[model samples]
Structure formats: C-alpha cells, structure tokens
Target chain A: MKKNYSNEDLHSEQGATISGQQQKAIVCNGLTKQFGSFRAVDNISFDVNEGEIFGFLGANGAGKTTAMRILCGLSYPTSGEATVAGFDVYKQQERIKKNIGYMSQKFSLYDNLTLLENIEFYGGVYGVSRSEIKIRSSDLISTLGLQKEAHKLVSELPLGWKQKLAFSVAIFHRPKIVFLDEPTGGVDPVTRRQFWDMIYEAAANGITVFVTTHYMDEAEYCNRISVMVDGRVEALDTPANLKKQYKTNSMNDVFYELARGAKRADN
Target chain B: MNSVEVINIVKTYGEVKAVKNVSFEVAKGELFGLIGPDGAGKTSLFRVLTTLLLADSGTATVEGFDVVKDYREIRNRVGYMPGRFSLYQDLTVEENLSFFATVFGTTIRENYDLIKDIYEQIAPFNSRRAGKLSGGMKQKLALCCALIHKPDVLFLDEPTTGVDVVSRREFWEMLNKLKKQGITIVVSTPYMDEASLCDRIALIQDGTVMSINSPDRIVKNFPKTLFAAKANNIYKLLQDLRRNSEMESCYAFGEYIHFTVKADDADIVRISQIAERENHDGLEVKQVIPGIEDCFIRLTLDSGQKIMDRKK
Candidate 1:
C-alpha cells in the first residue's frame, strides 16, 4: 500500500494543493515529452512525499533522464503540468532551481578550475555570499578528502575523488531536495556506499533525494522508486512492495516483466 | 593448468596503497567476479591482471602465461573494457569494430558469428559515429570490439554502468550467453546484485576478502532473525525502535525499517503495542528473509559499527 497522507499535511506546505500535496515532494500529472514522433517521456503522473528518496528508474532511453529533466526544470513537459518543490516548473523554474540542487549523471567538474575555484564559481552563480561559499566549500572539500586537491585543478583529481566532490557541491546549497542522475555511475561500491551515506545524512536533515540509476540493487536504496517504461510510470512504491508485487526476487526481473508486458500491450 | 592465478600481488601509487597483497584464480571457462565497492582495489586488480600496469610485488598467470613476462601476448588474447567508455570517438560503429578486429590481426568477418547478435542490434546505425551512439549501443559496440579477437578471457569493469537500465539488463543477458561459449569471464562491479549473477564472487572490502561464495549460500549463511517493520511516521518509529533495548540494529530499508533483536528475546511481540503507545497508526511488522543488502549490513555491523535496537 502507498503511504497515505492527510489532506492537512498535504496542503500544509506553502502554495501547495491538497490533491497533489499528498505526494508533494514531486507532483506530475499527464506529463509527456515528445521529440517529433518519438515520445521520450510518455504521459505519466506520480507523487513523491515531502521528504522521500524517490528513485526515478529506467533503462537508457526508458525516459528516465527525460522525465528527470522535465521534473528538474531543465526541460519542459510537452503537454502536462509539473510542480517541483511546490513551484511550477515552467514559470517558477528559478524558484525551483534555488530550492533544489542537481547533479547530472555527467556531473562534469571543470578540469581547469581548482576544487575551491569550481565551488566558488558555482556558489557565486547561485548568488551565495562569498564568505558563506568559502566556509562551506572548505568544509565540504575536507569532508570529501580534497583539501590538498582544493588547490589543484579538478582534472588533476582521480575519478573517484571527482565524483565525491561533485556530490558535495551539488548539495552545498542545502536545497530542500537534491536530484542525482546516476551520480554513482562509475563509482566504486565503497564510494557509492559512502555516497549513499551522504544522501542519507542529507535526508535526515530533511532534504528529499531524487535519483536515477540502472543498478537494481541501488533501487533497494531508495525509499520509494518509480520504474518508467515507454514513458509511463508502470510501477511505483517501495522496492520491497514492487518486488513482492511482481513476485520477482529482484528489481531487474520486475523491470523485464513490465517491459515485456508493455511490449505485448503495444503489439 | 589454471587459466588465471595470482600470488601476493601489490600495486600502489605514491604513498597510497591502491592494492595490497591481492591474489585469486579463475578456472578455464569459469565466470569469476572481483566484487568490491569503489576503492576496494578492484580497478587496480583489473589493471594488474590485464597487464596495463605492473604490480609492485606478487606474480600472476593467465592461460599458463605470466601476466608480466607475457604482457603483450596476454593483451592480444584477453578482452578488456575499462569502467569508463574508451573507444575511438571519430570512428563509426562498423569502423570501430573493424578497427579493433584489425588491431588484433583479425577481421570482423572472421569473428562475425561471435558478435552477430550484438552487432545486429546496432548494425542499422553502422555508419553512426562511435561518439554518436546511445549509451547502450556504445556499450554493445565496445563489447563487439573486445570480442572481435575471440579472446580466451574477458575482463569487464563496470560495463553496464552509465547505460540505461534496459540496456544494462540486455548487457548482462549477453554476458550470460558468452559464459556458455566457454569464455573465462572475469568481471568486477560494486553492485551487490550483479555480484550474484556471477558463478562465484569475492566480497572485497578495504583490500581484503570478506567472503567468497555463491550468492545463495552467502544469503543462506546470514545468521540473524531479520524483521521489517514500519508505521505512521516510519522514520520516527525507526528512531524510537533503535532506542529500545530489545533491538540490535535498526536500519531504514526502503519503505519499512529492517531490524534485528537479541536472538533469545521473545519480546518481539511488543512492537505493535509500542507503536500504539507512540501514537502510530497501523504499524506493520513482519519477519523477512535476508537478501544481499542484509548480508552486507550484518557484515558491516560485525566489523564493529555498533547498531542498536529500539528501547521500551
């Protein structure tokens, strides 16, 4: 069963609606994105709770990134409405940007800038105070074991270190929510585990996390995950529930089952 | 004759010890996995085995040839796909495959049967540049190139990573098929679930092996009466449960909280009433079987993280 929220709690957040508030961390209705004849993200709807670690999952081109772009205000929905963090994605994208931190799967840290400079530049772009950026940047740099590398160009750092530092910068703003599109793609398991720990720490401090990954095991990490196929959220709920519902021991099986089902339906 | 064998291999960079005294073996036609999280020396181990880097110490042999002394021969005979996408970006799909095959002194036509299934999927885009292919297609092309030489052993380092999920599944499916072809596959991944897909896995942490066994046996060996419980304000319930003296370790597992208690304690029945007292509605608690993640958690706790249960 999905977590049922009270109408009052749903509407408690500022400028939020009760119908969409129950699943308010993210609310998308009839969301669709099309590139000419191809529907990148088909019409879909789902609600993410106030502080849920919602997993936006799919195979490559399964519309996972496309859906994320729409929700993140990076790309517009073809014919639907989406409100991210209670701000309309289309009009209040700036507000949404301020309230959410994003780490693209290709979270490319500039090779030319030192760790500190990259952090400073991003912080400056976000209109953060110079003093605040410096303080948080150093603390984050140290936490990620990049103190020595802070003075070195990001290109000089290893891939593992680059990934960790990227994560620190993404959430440096302490946004209400953070979006990670395959943030741990090539990271080692230990580092990925550490990354998940950081995600948990952020969640504990009341930050919602939205992530997309191909690894089914990582699906087990999200509090709730939605599997997109052919542009619709075919399955949604906790990993356990979805696994049990599909009678599959793993999310991989669930994905195959739904994908096959979708194909059969299409034919 | 062992297909792959190593003794006390050590690799390091500067003051940091990337790999320390690591050794393992892979039998001919066997699918072996070097399972570890990032920084667990997986990449270093792969690099050493593939002969891309020399070990500071220790010795290794593949197909009866020494990894160091016969490094060039080994390079030509083994397939190596690094974690990151490494291919000629300017080359087209067909060109990339042909180039790799030619590099190994072979032709794609000679090994056409080997990569036919995979290549066919992207053949329509044979003229598409390697840089232009989708993540999944790029993965297929890379695999095709790696297999073009029909190597005796295959080394894939997080091959499915960065690809879409559907493609990831397809890739694993392809690997399974290759295993049937008598290819000795040595793959590494930080993903625990993928670890299970291998014939046998070595769970490495901090440059040490935690366990080496089949996935089923490993989960079966988990020694804990794991239970999943959750209620209204589930996170709060987890915190409250951890404070309880009966609980041993309480972790948030997806929608529910996975917990363990002292084995002898029959006070497990107290969860519902406690939830009621905490003003939690419909507290659902049930005993659950352990999975790979569960095994990992217990392993972490065993190594001394001190996970506690909720108190009354």
Candidate 2:
C-alpha cells in the first residue's frame, strides 16, 4: 500500500499542468547531462512546489553536484528540460540567477570583509538599491545580535557565527529560491539546529528551499527528499512514506538499500 | 602503556587560546575519537600530539616518545592526515602515495599489505592527478598514502566531514580492519554518529574536553530523561514547546523535537497534554534514549553555563 502511494505521488506531478494556482518553483523532465561518454546526470525528473523544502541527496560522485549546477544555471544540460523560478535553464540562465540564492560550505561570504560589509556587498550584487541595503543590513546585524562585532572582519568570527551570517547574506535580497550545499558540514550540533531554524523561517516566508546535505537526520526534516545513486534518482518521497516503503526506521537505511547496489564506485 | 598521552596541553595563537589545557590518553591498538565541531580545537590538539606544533605548556607523547623533546622520532612513528587536502595536487595518485612512502624511509612494496584493502579501491585511477580525482577517490588515496608508511599510530582529522553516507560507512569498515592489525588510530570528526564507532571518545568543545568515555557510557550518563515529540507542524511545535514553562530545553532532531523538562517524572502523557493545549495537530510524544549528540549538547550547555557563572 505504501509503495503504491509513493508511486502515485511521484507520477502525480510528472507532466502535470502548471495552473495559476499550485505553482512549481522548479520543474525538470528527463534532465540529462553528458560529458564525453560519461553521463553525469541520467534522465531525471522531479518538481519542487512553491515554498517547499526539498532535499537533494546522493552519494559522493553520484552526479548530484552536476544536477544542482544545471538547476542553478551554472552549467547547461546536454539534453532534457529544466526550469527554475519559471525561467528556462538554457535560454534564461541569467533570469534564473537573478531570482535564486546559492550558498556552499566551501564558499559563502568574503572573509576579509566585515559582517556588515559582506551583507551590503551581497545585497548590492543582487541589485538591491543602495538605500534599501543600508536599512536592511542594520536591521539584519541587530537581528543577529552582532551589533558590537558588525564592524569586525568576518574571519574573526567563529564558525557558527560565520555560517549564520553567510546564510543571512544569501537571502538578503529576498530571492525566490535558496540553494544550500552542505551548509552545516562541520558546525556544532546546537549551531546546526539554529541554522535549520533559519531554513524553516525562510520556508515559512513563502521562499522555496532546495538543499543538499550529508546528515541523514537532516534528510528527515525535508518535506520531500530525492536520493540519487549512480546518476539516477533511486527514491523520491516523503520521509515517512519512504521509510514505510523500504521497511526501515530511518532515511539512512533507505539510502543504503538503494545505493548499496550501485555499480559505479565513488570516483 | 598508552599509545598517546596529552597532559594539560595548552596552545594559543595571539589572543586566542585554541587549545586550553586539554588532556586525554589513548590505549595501544585502540580506535579513539576526538569528536567536536569546527574551531573546537581538535586540530590544535592533533597537531600538538603529532609534533607539528608546540604547546605553550604541558606535554604530549606519541608511541612513547615526547612530542617536543623527541619530535623527530614521534614524527617518524605516527601518520597524520590533516583536515584539509594537503597532498600535492599536481602529483598523480601513484606519485603522491609513493612520495609519502619514500619520505618515511619506506616503499609501497614494504607495507603493501597494510594499505592493500584501501589502495586497491583507488588503484584503477593511480595515474590520475590528485586534483582530478573525485572527492571520495581523493579521500581513499589520502588514506592509502597515510597507511603506506605502516606507522604505529594514525591521526585522521575530520576524515568524513563532507563525505556521503555510503562512503562514510565504508570508511568506518576499513578502520575496523586496520584496528585488527594492532595500529592505534585517533580520528576526529564533526559527525556525532561516528563517535559510537570508536572504542572511546573525548567530547571537546571550546578548546576543553567535556567528557571522555566509551559511547555507550556517555549516553548512559545523560542526567535527564529525554522525550521525542512530533506534531503536524514541527517548527510551530518547537516554538510552542519552548514557550511552555515546564520544558527546560527543546531542539529539533530530524522528524521530531527532542526535549527535556525541568521537573522529574515528566512522561509522554504530560508532554502530550502540553502539545495538545498548544492546538497542534497529529501530536505524538514518547520517551527515547539519548544519543551521543544529545549528550554532547547537554554537556556543551552545562559548560557554557559554567563559563557564565565564572564571569559572574
């Protein structure tokens, strides 16, 4: 019964019409990316509803980064169709970039810049007006309670504080969608929770959240998750439904079940 | 005799005390873990014991040799894989592994059996440049290089920080194999779940050791009975739970909120009543055993309170 329900959920959105209501923030149909003879992203299809928190999970070298890059407009797909924030991945890459925020653990805010300065720089880069950037940045600094340290260089702050600031800066322009790639990689447990609360807040405010993480517990927090193995999405469903289908107690088991059979080694 | 010993080691950089009088010991052939988040001074402690950096005070010994006085001897007896990828990016996988082997006055053939299980996985890409390999492949090669010398002790810093679940599980399995060979391994990781895999762990935070014991013992030592609660809206439930005066602390843990109450004997029924009063839908609450993360969080909070009290 659970298997049938999951299959229905997966197929219900595929090739579904986008009406005035029930808008989708992202839509991909048979998306494929090939490099020479290697297909990094096999024919994959999924849709993320507006204001939904979607988790994109995969093993190392499973083509998750490639798929994300195509969706974020950083790279073009070899074939198949994908649209982000109602903009085409191929033709409207610039439009997609303008409406999305991207943050990765390896790269986020500028280290040399002060907290306030980093906010202003990212705000300006997103095309927010100078006057608005001024007011919002101050409000942001106070909201984060970094008032005394607002002028201090970002490099001086602890890892937790830097991550929070980087996240706040990513969404400063109020982009429609935010992409976080392993945002809480090495963050402390408490700080990691605080970061998730920020994600929850962003989702509450009608902004779509698309994230990738290695923590299986975090996978349970997503409204729906798609697990990729060997460039193919092996499972896509709500955490509860996936668990029932796989007869497991957690997302970790579900992932191991699907990925264990993968012929492609992590390379 | 202990394979590694750190006696009140203190390391500072200018105004920051990166490692504050931290001390721990690892038994010979034991899989010990230094578990903490970033900037928790795991690296500083590892560096001091590995003889790469000198502690401002205190002493450390690896393989029965003083870290400071017998630095060269300690260096030769231990293998260290830093947090960052320190291998030569321009060098091929084979080149990097062979170079490390030669540096330690050994060759790949000399200790081929020690690294055979790990190196064989990446041997297919032996000619590929280190930079060209994928993240998982790079880590595998790094492990192979670290083991090629067949050192008596191994120090791995955050080896699985960004690795996926499948790869991480595989890595742990490999570690277990190495342990059977009688090589003392000390690994550091931000992932709390990995703590249980170690024979013993030292939970460090803010440059101090919070606790050191087997994972089961640490979890068993949780001072409060924990509860896991769920509702239709987890975030709303979290906010509502925090507002309740009866609750001492509440944090989101995956699908549910794991919390503790101020009063003793706070069972599932009492927590359910609190959630229902908040007008939550589909409320479910139950008592659950604490994990390493829960213990870590509780310890960190307690230490933080201690610091606040000291200031007062």
Candidate 3:
C-alpha cells in the first residue's frame, strides 16, 4: 500500500538526496508515446513517491492527458518504460487496470442515475464486494455532504456538488493510485477548497493521487508537480522550489515561464 | 446612462433555479464582473443580461431598453461572446466578422477602426477557417466578431476559461482597450486573481452574491494577521500545524500556509517553535499581502458557518 504525502515533504530534501528508495510507488524512465508524426508524450522520466499527490500541469495541448492515459494503461506508450505499482505498464496493463482508478476530465456521473446507483455501478464493474460498496458508499456520501441528494439524479444536482460526488466515487474502490484529469476545472472557490480537503483525506488514508489541472492555484495543492510541455517534462519539483527557480510569485507566472516557448515550439 | 440593471430577475430551466432572484447594476463604462465557477449561474446570468434568453420573472434593461419587450433594440446595442466559441467554425476569420456585422445590419469595414487592435493580429490569417486557428487566435477572432457591431455594452462570459496564460492576458488587454473606448463591459470568470482587473465584482457562489466590491477593498477587508510558513515537509507541516493548539486556522497557500492565529493566543515565537519541533526544514516566515485567495479562505472561516469542528 502507498503512504500519503504532502507536497512539502517531497520538497524538503530537494536535489535528489534519496534516489531509488524501495518505497517509491511509480517510476518512469525515458517514457515516450507517439501518434504517427506527432509525439504526444516525449522522453519524460520521473517518479511518484508512494501516496503522493503528483500534479501534471501544462497548456491545453501539452500532452498531460496523454501521459496519464499511458500511466493508467488506457493508451500504449510508443517507447521507454514506466512501472506503475511496480508492474510494467506495457506488459502488465491488465494488472495496472485492476489496481488503479481513473477519473477523467469529463467524469460526469451517470446524470440520470441516482448517487447510490452510480456508486454501485462503478463498484460492481470494478468487482468490489456488494457489502463493501454499501458500507463505502454511505461513508463517502456523508463525508461529501450528499446525504440529501443521494437519491436525486446526478443531472439535478448543481455542478459543484456533482464534482465532489464524482470525485468521491472515483476513489471509492480503494485503488492504489487514482488518476484525476482536471477534477477542479470549473468549480467554485469554496467547492474547490472543500475538494482539496477531500484530497487531503484521501492522501491521509494512504492513496496515491495523480491529478492534471490547468488552474495554477490548484497546482499549489499537490505534493509534487511536473510541468509537461510539448510532450516533455519541463520542470518537476515541489511548488516552492519551482517558484524559486522560475522567479515568479504565483504558479501562473511559473507556468508561463515554463510553457510559453515550449508550447509554441511544439506547434 | 446606466450601463445595465436587473430588477428581481429570475431564470429557471424547468424545476431548477439556475439564476434565482438576482439583481445588480453596472454603471456606464465600468468593468463589472460575475465571478464564480461553473454552474454558479454565471453563464445564465450573462445570457439574460445580453438578451439571449428572457428572465422568467422581473425585468432587465440594457442601455435603457427592456430585454424582453425591447430585445431587438437591446440586441442591436450589446456585444456578446458566449462561454463556448459560438462563432461559425466553417467560416474564415474575415467571413465570421463580416457575418456578425451583417447580422447587426452593419459592415465590418464600417467599424474596422474600433476592432483594429485585435483584428489586425489575425487579419493575416483572415482566410483561415475559424476552427483551424489556434486558441489565442480563436479568442481574438471571437472578440473581433463581438466588436464588429460596435455595441454600446459588451457581455463576455468566461472568455478566458480554456485559453493559455499568454492568450488570457492578451484577451484581458483587449478588454481594457475596449473599456477605454467607453464600451461598458460585464465579463465573467472563474479565476479569482482576475478580479483585481474589474472595476467592481460580485463574488458569487451557489448562485448567491458573496461580496461586491473592488478587489483592493475586498482584500483590505480580510481580517486577521496572515503568515507564510514553510519547512521541509509542507504536507506534514500543514497536518501538524492544523493540529497545534495555538493556531486558529492553517491551510495551504501557494508555497506556504496562509494561516490566521487565534486572537490573543500566541505570538510568532510560538508558531515557529511548533514548526521547528515538527522538524519542518528551512522554515521561513513572512508578513505577506492578502490576495483574493486569502480573502476567499477568510470568507469561509469567518462566516461562522462551521461545517465541522476545527481540528485544533
């Protein structure tokens, strides 16, 4: 099982004090994915420590979604190697699928389905026990404040509430690592703050989180983040160090500094 | 003349109340903003204000014309670009601008000077299909189409939501230029930091006004002393600080925790000591300016609506 970690811890030691620790949950080496003439994910290499909320950031076409898709075994990598949960992504895709949960950028719950039904469908498809799903669904709905809305259809709920509910369902199965693509894109600040709290709780409970977001502010929430630009990992570090290196006050500026040219260069 | 006003306006999509009893006024030539995340009723508010959709109840007047009764007149006087790129994707840049201008019973060449700054950048790509252009170009073209009519008021809903930083900055610059030309503008955005650019904003959430004031005044209203403290392990530091009895509330703020101390609780000495005891490395502390994010965090905590007991 992975242990949860905040961004500060991974940043403290800085500069590779501990490399190849046995506890590292994810390792990527020369990972590359290509689509004919276009390279979606170029030669990128990084490791996600056990239970760390790793943030993947870039412009709209920076290949962030592609990298995560490859990690989750949803797509094939063109070259290089990645070991998720210590299993080779290419050779053990089925094993990776079994152990990981994925929530897409458009992870809209079945709108017409009741909250409980949505949870049951995801759990049932994942093969979680009926008893476990029942117990877990109740705990999740309560924590996310969906008690009154549990019986309501997802389409009827407000977008913020739906966002929280979707996230809750994403992690309900206790997957070793959960990959989220822009989970907080269009949510209110209050709901965003609450969503981060849920993420903290998940990390505390020993679940590794890999998330992608364009909202630079949300980048502050990750334990460690990597800037993917034009199919390459441009910068990967704790938020503080990245800000220092980029000489910027906010992640918005840092992202611009990293992505400004690489983005244009790619196109 | 007042730019726009809504009186007890109500909008509903069947049983759901997207915009509920909303009312606000935008003075002439002012940059008023409707700030909220998705489904905070931002787009719906804009649709009603721009006269795209009629309010179910109450009244709205844009440039002194009713949105329902005087919609054709109101439509002739307002420039609007929806949240999505609603321009004709099949048309070229020039064609789209000309089409919009023709729809308003005008011509782009007649108002080319007004959109000269934005239209010039994409004029070289005037023949490019709207869909073939890059995100930034698409935004510029959209602005051009909206400006072709040279309407007295402008309504932009989440124009920067999906664009890159460079493009977003460019779009804001265009808005500033348009504002200077005395075109009253009401824009909506989910990003709080952009609130500072507005003359006044209604910080909304869940379809209710949280606060309405300039960004500077809003930040000035944030109560309590804030500090940015960081160590080697920031995650554990937050968990550790949140548990410490001395601090009132501590949450992650960018590179450090934007924490507020309990009144008369303890000084900075005690705060650093707690951090040090936890072996938080390189712990640096500073007095920093409160930003929109800080104000937002304070609003939730100071509202006295505690969801759960503070972990302290």
Between candidates 2 and 3, name the one with more favorable DockQ: 2
lDDT by residue (tens digit), candidate 3, B155-233: 9989988666766777898899999999999999988878889999887765666777888898898777677787666
Candidate 1: lDDT over CA atoms?
Answer: 0.75
Task: List the candidates ranked by DockQ, beginning with the highest.
Answer: 2, 3, 1
| Winning model by DockQ | 2
| TM-score, cand. 1 | 0.79
lDDT score, candidate 3: 0.79
Per prediction, the TM-score for chain B is 0.91, 0.96, 0.92
lDDT of 2 by residue, B99-121 (tens): 99999889999999999999999
Stretches of model 2 off by over 4 angstroms after superposition: A1-21, A265-267, B305-312
Ten-residue region with minimum lDDT total, candidate 2 chain B? B303-312
- Estimated TM-score for each candidate: 0.79, 0.93, 0.88
Give model 3's TM-score versus the native structure.
Answer: 0.88
Candidates, DockQ: 0.25, 0.38, 0.32
Q: What does the lDDT come to for candidate 2?
A: 0.87
Clashing pairs in 2: none
Candidate with more favorable, higher DockQ: 1 or 2: 2
